[model samples]
Target: VCVFAVKVGFQGKEFAESFEVGLALAVGMTPQLLPAITSVVLAAGAKVMSRHQVIVKQLLAIENLGSMTVLCSDKTGTLTEGIIQLHDTLGIEGSPSERVQELAFYNAFFQTGFANPIDRAIRDSREFPTSDIEKLDEIPYDFIRKRLSVRIRRNGDSLLITKGALAHVLECCSTVETADGSLADLGPYREAIDSRFIELSNAGLRVLGLAIRNVDTPHLHKEDETGMTLVGFLVFADPPKADARETIEQLRDLGVGLKVITGDNRAVAESISKRVGIMSPVIVTGTDLRQLSDEALFQRAREADIFAEVEPNQKEQIILALKKGGQIVGYLGDGINDASALHAADVGISVSSAVDVAREAAQVVLLKQDLGILVQGVREGRKTLANTLKYVFFAIAANFGYMFSLAVASVFMPFEPLLAHQILLVNLLADFPAMSLATDSVDPEQIHRPRRWDVGYVVRFMMSFGFASSIFDFMTFGAIYYIFGGDKPELFQTGWFVESTLAGLMILMVIRTQRPFLLSKPGALFLFAVLSITLITIWIPYSPFSEKLGFVTPPPMLMVIALGVTFLYGVGMEIVKALFYRYLAHR
Candidate 1:
């Protein structure tokens, strides 16, 4: 508006033409198609992700997933097969015991809660005649207690069995059920048992401490879980998936950092990470986290590779800290404890079988939970981001380039450089081909790592390409006046418009990729779209509506000369683009 008023003030005789030209330039600079093209490109990427077995629940996640620098996940379902198998059942003496196996089986069978993977593993690993046992009472498992207790009767004797995380279950044990069924003070064996637990954990075995005691009463409650005999360990192993190592390698190669956030202890987390080929892991245990302030943790969050032994509620804190440290964090979560973290992360990924709460909070849901599937989604995500950036680059450079050319031409030319409608037509036509950008193949090198929108990067591209475009505009202005006879303003305007439209639309191909324009082949849809715009640009000036649009058909050889200039412009832009990307590569 101000530009239009100022132009009219200076050029009172050509007031109407100045007003129209000013309006056209302002409209051209506005990113009229930004939202429209971004939505179409992102929606297209989501379909590609669906083919990779990834479902995007939130549309914005498509771009966020592409920009994710760190992914935090529990090692179980994603990095490893969720299927668990009972590795061993051992006594307090660190030897296999039938008594401990029987106790674990009975507890697994009698508890009223859902049969979890560990319970199913226990039931499958041993044969137990279920007909002889009678369930009297049970205490269901909760993450807070981290243990479940069940009281059962068999052969006229009643007993209570408890099994859960070693640290939590060990707190309830007053004695140890050593080999041969002899009970001894737990204090004598606490250190040895803890050491055994660590050793088993360090070997990547998930250990559950089993405890047993005579229960005269039939009722079982939280208070009744204490004073039991520590029977032995029920160890389970959930090895990494067949392709887990390769998947981790692929993620690293794609510049995505892996961070394990699990309920497992530091040794267990480290052990599993190493098994999956993650090296030199820095571990932050939940115990250590409990003592640290939010500020302290935020500073330390980016330094660690694993957040170990974190409680369910603390998961949100870890994600928040990473986000605060400027990471576009992607969190994989499924448990009820994961809702907060899922909602807090930049992009939350959940499995198909995830809990309802988790799935609802997540932005992406995987039909099959595997790190490899995530890699495919990331590729599609980066493609979406790349295409959008390409459009933005074209819009900024082309529009600003023409604006610069118009400002310089208006100063010396007797007539308006381009009528209002001609400049608007240029802006509209230049944007037509860019709508097909989603069909263009992105440079794999650009998407190798996470990318964020940088204003400075965009500005540099605008200035460089815009300046190159202005140079051609200057050449066209000189040619129209000296060689083509621009005594009439219509002739000069028509000549420059033809040249600017041809060169501006071609900017898409040059800025589409860092590779040389000919080397990086564009997709068929994009090529067709660009050709369509080119044909319209060549036909419009010679068409019947030329008079209404303030255009006079150029002399016989003027278009041929415009075509020659456009060719030179493409060659010049290609060289400028090559040098510009090379400088960026060095930077």
Candidate 2:
């Protein structure tokens, strides 16, 4: 109103004429409740997502979560229980032996960085007399080396003990120690050892190689890592959680793709991935990734599901490559190694038990490691998006129709179709029903796939429904001016106001879903609000407030004709909706 007054003063237009024209123009514009409606809807969705054990740290991430096309998740803790137990120890000949277990126990017992589950498994298995064993030095684990080494003294002789990924350890060994305590050249048995590793990994055993070397010096250097005797293989088993396969299937059904990224061997990762039903069969290793350029990596990243033996930096690179392939990537991890990848992803997701670095980098966190909870969050996000778009489409359509009616009517009549104050009253009364749209139920079919805002789709939907609504408004104008003799301003405003309110409320029922209105019932609050607002709007002009609001009661015959026009408008919109969705499906 203030802006219009300023325009009138600046343009030197007459106050009476400008004020009346401004009111007519304002009434034709879209409703002013969009920001408030969006806030209410998003807050309600946040509350629903909270109940599913998913915490949304960034509220805007909720929308991105819905649009996520690829989920790159770590397998150990996120997909499994992360509880590893020492299952067996194998000699260099692939035979189970007690001597290998004893060597593994000492290697795990003496040294420490942070506590590891694999170390805990071995330490808790049996008590070793460490009083006779003295620690000399240690090399902590590194992702590139994939191993940790410790030098210790037993019986006044210094020996260096190393354990890590089986293949990595094999490259460092020159000889093998058999169960009989004899050393043989590791060259002849290298092929057999690799075959044995594959067999064990395929069986889902997390396999590691242990090696030791007798050194005269008290210290061990990185150069000393070579010329070591490969002692044996330590086998650990971490079972997948019971619900993992079901979770994978559920996500697949929702049009979300899953990929596994881990530092484990390709055989082990592949065996586990197949069991959990991951789709892409190609595996890319960190070494294989390094040899490829960024363009090559991007092409492979699209078809590869298992990224094995990936370093933290490689993990970040893989995420970037996937994004380049045009996917909205979501990374889930709990270890400090995952922080870089988490930050690189479009939406970083973590669990409640994740390390501080990982948690801080994540935008969304699952309070539990349950994939079911994440699925629920996705559904809720799509629901919020679907309903928000519904309101926009309905508003644009109904407003366009009301505006078109006023533009056409003004050319034939000298008076304003509606007063400025009456237009505001009608807008206020109509919006009371829209507040309930946020909490309304969304159809399962609408949420079966990922949903995102498409400007082209919105424009098409608005024009198709908006123009159909205009046809009905023109029909109502004909009834008021020709049939009921309501050519005067007071009678025309009252008649058109009642008809416009009914049309907006009735059109909401059609646009809120793709299905017919009878099959998709709205929530009780929405239904009650729409019904109550409709009744009150129809009864307003007959009330004592009618004269003060510049309205007059229409005749009984005119009321009957308004109902007929509204009914036909609804039927016409239903037909347009069917054709519009059909057009959308083909597109």
What C-alpha lDDT values do all the predictions have? 0.86, 0.83
Q: Point to the candidate with the largest TM-score.
A: 1
For model 2, what is the alpha-carbon lDDT of residue 549? Answer: 89
Write model 1 residue lDDT over 1-587, tens digit each, in one string: 65666567765646776767777777888888999999899899998899999999888899999999999999998777988899999998899878889889999988889557888898888878879888898889988899999888889888888999999998898999778777899999999998999899999989999998788864666988889889999888998888999998888888889889999878878888898888899889988889999899997788988998889878889889999999999999888888999999999999998889889999999998888999999888998998999999888887778788887677567677787788888878877788889778887787898887788888788888888888888888888788866678887777777888888767788888888788888878898988988898888889999989989888867788788898998899898988788785334
Full-model lDDT, candidate 1: 0.86
Output candidate 2 Cα RMSD.
Answer: 3.2
lDDT of candidate model 2 versus the reference: 0.83
- In candidate 1, list every pair of residues with a backbone clash: none
Best by lDDT: 1
Q: Model 2: per-residue lDDT, tens digit, 1-587?
A: 64346546655556876577566567547566778888788888888998998888887787778888888998886567688889888898888877777777887887777677888898877766788888898888888788888888899888889999988888789999977889999989899888889899998788999999887775667778889999899999888888889998888888888889998888889888877776458899888999998899999899898899889899999999999988888898888889999899988999998888889999999998777788888888888887777778777877766666665555445566666677667677768778899899989998898877778887787788877887888778877877756547788888888888888888988888899887997988889999999899889989988999888988887777777888888888889989988876336
Clashes in model 2: which pairs? none
| Per-candidate TM-score against the hidden true structure | 0.93, 0.91
